[model samples]
Target: MFNKKHYKFNLNSTFAKLLGSYLIIISLILTTSSLVFFRKYEKLIVTQEYNLSEKLLNQANYYVDFNIQWATSFLYSLYLDEDIYDLMFSQSSHYKKNGISKLKHLNLSSSNIDSIFIYNKFDDKFYSSLGSPAENYYLPSMKNIIYKSKNTFTDAFIPSQIKINLKNNNITKNIISIAILTSKSSEKSLSSAVILNLNANTFSNYFKHNITNNSNLFVMDNNGT
Candidate 1:
């Protein structure tokens, strides 16, 4: 009297229908949630990275402006000194001695300039703040600035590759030489030049310590070498 086979068939059919519906509905909900989360997380990560990059660029710009200000200040100050005029017009052992002393003092006091020199074209000798008798040497580079500048002209930065012989010793340095063209009187004639050597590495070192260790900074001479 009991129809066991028919009863079993009905039970299996009911269970299969319920399981199919449950799988389909649950899969749809999970896939939708995963899609939405991925898009939001991706946008957040991209935004954060862009902001960080902009901040670093701003920091670099600030440092560059600060350096330029300091450079102009020091160079203009040297341009205004009257001792340079005396060095050119007067020639005395005592005068030369005092000149060297004054130069050495100025070099010591300056925070940004490394060395200063006033080259007397008439005497054909270079006098430096370092107190080392400037050597007579020939350089195969642009000579127009040395010969032609009539006003205060700072030469474009020239990266030092060839060692400059100072006191008979050679050294490689990155420097900018500010050429201060002088005249005995204002008559469109330049009598001599005062060269101010500014060390580029000094300014870079200031920010290098404060900036992140990963930040890369380089200072080169006018030649871009």
Candidate 2:
């Protein structure tokens, strides 16, 4: 007598329960492995991104500092120029005019120079390549700055420390400035300052190009402004 009910399958059977438990344990193991792999992959991606950002920042910093060094060296060279010194201290207007013409020629030597101005505290006059009365407005503002170095760069102008808007040129742009006192003596109150203004586009463009859409980079001075 063969009875089929004796061999009938049942969900509540011990064997069925054991199979279900095995599947659940296998699922948990697989899930845990996948989670661990995902975390490791995430960490690797983060480390790679951090390394890239740091490298780019270092490169940008190098280029920026190099440009500033070039500017300061250029300014110092111009400061020592006999013609420039004569222009700053000469009593004759004709000699000063000649110096101004020489300044125009010097201004053309570099494309980075926005403008060069020489302020003689003795005569209370502004001599610049721009040859515009607007220099008077700008030169006075720089006079108040407590200079920390003989040939040091001014702070990067996020908003432009000295704004220039000339009617003839009609061009508005940001600039970084470096000024040198022309007097040889200790009494600097009556001395002249030769100021060289550099276009800030070189630095701004590098930062803009290196930064990603998700990241931001800032170049700050000692003041951290």
Best by TM-score: 2
lDDT of 1 by residue, 1-225 (tens): 986664444645878889888999999999999999999999999999788767765776677667666666766676566676556555655667767677889888766766777766566556777653332232322234465454556545433322567767877656555565664323343356666666767756766755666857664434564
TM-score of each: 0.64, 0.77
Window of ten residues with lowest summed lDDT in model 1? 133-142
Give per-residue CA lDDT, model 2, range 85-196, as digits (tens). Answer: 7677776787787779988897888878877887666686668886766665566545553133333334443234565566756555677776776543233563577778
Clashing pairs in 2: none
Task: Report, for all candidates in order, the number of backbone clashes.
Answer: 7, 0
Cα lDDT listed for each candidate: 0.62, 0.71
The best candidate in terms of lDDT: 2
Where in model 2 is the C-alpha error above 4 Å?
A: 1-8, 12-14, 133-137, 146-171, 183-190, 221-225
